[model samples]
Target chain A: MTDTQNSRDAVVIERTFDAPVVLIWRMWTEPEFLKEWYGPDGASIPIANMDVRVGGIRRVCMEMPSPNGPMQMWFTGEYREVVEHQRLVYTESVSAESGPVLSPTSPGTAGGHPMMTEVRVELEAVGNRTKMVMTHAGVPSDSPGAAGWAMALDKLAANIATNRGR
Target chain B: MTTAIDEDRLTETFAALANSTRRAILARLAEGGATVNELAEPFTLTLPAISKHIKVLERAGLVVRGQRAQYRPCVLDATPLEAVSTWADRYRPVWEARFDRMDDYLRQLRRQEGASEADD
Candidate 1:
């Protein structure tokens, strides 16, 4: 029995990079650069395809090495708003299609259980540094995929700021 | 064991830490392990009440309990707490971006007002 209903949970990640606001925004929109730094340490992005336009769907899958075995997660989202180099908003769902399904509580729990998520990415300039904030709202409190997504984002930011510390 | 540390686990952990009393209990455990009596000594509630709070903490993996004779000792588990720090550190840029956006909006308003003043 599914005890979880849809709930809104917000996570704000603010990082100041030595690069300009535009450069930082590029790292997010460009599929090639994003492929270099999107998932966790061991997770790799074999599929980084994006339409980069409004109402366009971007589907990316991550290959994660698990102790039990190797696993793959399909992160499919639609680009709701794509403002030049300032702000980007997208709604991400676990299913391969456009509708909802059973929510996956964790990373490996996706096939039978699926959860929907929405992420907003904003970029602004702070003095010589650029600050980017991505807020993820409407994640199930009991879903495992939510936690995996948080980790993946953290690793992604670190990979971007590996050299330039601000 | 829900060994998988994911968003759901984090929410449950944070919700458990949302309580001030439970946070204090964690602070106490950090110093060293303690039993129900020792854990409840600093609290205003009874031992049974503290036990309930400890149970919540244990479920979140913030604290671990061991059976020793008649007393169950609680140990501080810092692994799950690090998850919050790791996740928050990712968005240091996002906050700066928001602040800059606000600053630009204010600056533009000032510039527009000055232009009107010059026209007058």
Candidate 2:
């Protein structure tokens, strides 16, 4: 069935940091700082290529240890918006290295557009604290891809909180 | 009961939602409760097939089907979807952070590469 259904579902996470907006922005926009925190607890992102301009592409390969086994997924998409130190928006579709995306909803998307999800992140400076809010949309309400994305996000969060490098 | 949930429940709930058909069914029910016949009307599948699908959804506790006047009306049980949202909420920052860092690294690499080429 051709699922043309569109739902504006979003996931928002707000974090108030004890640091300045510039430092927080650096953690987000700098690769060196990113490597310190960007994945689940056990998983690591060894490959990342990005261009933060409008219409530019951001690509990364993620590897994680799963109970079923170790797995990898390539997240590739284009930048929709980039504001120097305030906000960024991008859309991503997951695909495999040498194969089509496993998600059925997103096809021809970088690899296998099995599932397509849009992400928006906003950083608000409140005094010396920085409040960051992130929204993830376009996840099909019932697609397994959403679930996978959810799992990946969980690991991604732990990866960030425990990041000792930055 | 607002008890802490397990990973298995989360996984089951997400797996149940992986199908577009199931999502459609959920969306339909979200508009309001609907009977098996009403739900199946939109699809070309057989009544028993839709029933089976409902069973999967029911097992996931995403919907609470009630029998009313010869109709099995399904109500949306957003609990599981909430779980899914919670799971996604945990990692949104990590990915955003990664993307941000990646962008900077690539720009830096590109700049260095350009400068080297200029020197050559």
Candidate 3:
């Protein structure tokens, strides 16, 4: 009954790109191609060094121009699965720019623990187009800081149901 | 757009809600306001221990206690729960923007490929 409620904890997006599956796969895996459109419309990803192999390092630094100043973020993850144009899974940590993963007790982190999210992309060829289903959700069970995520994701729906029932 | 303070509060709120006992207390309070002893009836915790949990919920802004010491009823505050729900939506916009850029880049790559083929 809380299927919809559970879905609220994650971001699931499906989009069809105007290209074949191969191209779509490249756009996600390759560094140059990923940097071309990895952040906001105007934001530039200064560095996107990706090794598209299982267990390979995926380090990317996104620099965005904000009114306050230039904001920079470094995301470090490892390629969990590399299925070559079919499915790709990776771990993404929204950490400080080129620093340690902010701790759960770190102030202002809000959600406690660094935001360790998993990104899974599935691609299917549909003629000249490619259908992509991307899921950005909590960290894997084995990942560090994931214990906190388990709490954040698990009780949310029940919490909401309890509160909303009143 | 969640600011620094909101994020701080969310962290606090989540930390408070992380405990099973704390969550149960919140659920119990949702039914109606109750004194510390009344709230502790369903649980196997002591009065001071239950009061400690109530203190956490109060700090998280999830509960408020009455002023009268004789009977300060602990009431559930739905405000922080609202924050949790809203925070769930924080990722969609960022991803949408990134996907928009991905779409544009794909189109541009196609055009570049066509241009190179024309050169051949």
TM-score against native, each model: 0.43, 0.48, 0.75
Runs in model 2 deviating more than 4 A are A1-9, A65-70, A96-112, A140-166, B1-120
Model 2, residue B47: distance off in Å is 15
- Model 2 chain B: which ten-residue window has the lowest total lDDT? B1-10
**Model 2 C-alpha lDDT per residue in residues B9-92, reported as the tens digit of each score:** 554565576666776787677667889999999999999999998999999898898877778688877766656555455545
> How high a TM-score does candidate 3 get?
0.75
Give the per-residue lDDT of model 1 (tens digit) for A37-78.
Answer: 666557777887677888877777767787967666666767
Residue A40, candidate 1: how far off, in angstroms?
Answer: 9.8
Residue-level lDDT tens digits of model 1 in B32-87: 78998998998789878999999999988988999778787998777776665544
What candidate 3 gets wrong by more than 4 Å, as runs, is A1-6, A51-57, A78-80, A95-112, A138-166, B1-8
Docking class for candidate 2:
incorrect
User: After best superposition, candidate 2 residue A48: deviation in angstroms?
Assistant: 1.5
What DockQ results for candidate 3? 0.38
Best by lDDT: 3
Which candidate tops TM-score? Answer: 3
Worst 10 residues of 2 chain A by lDDT: A1-10
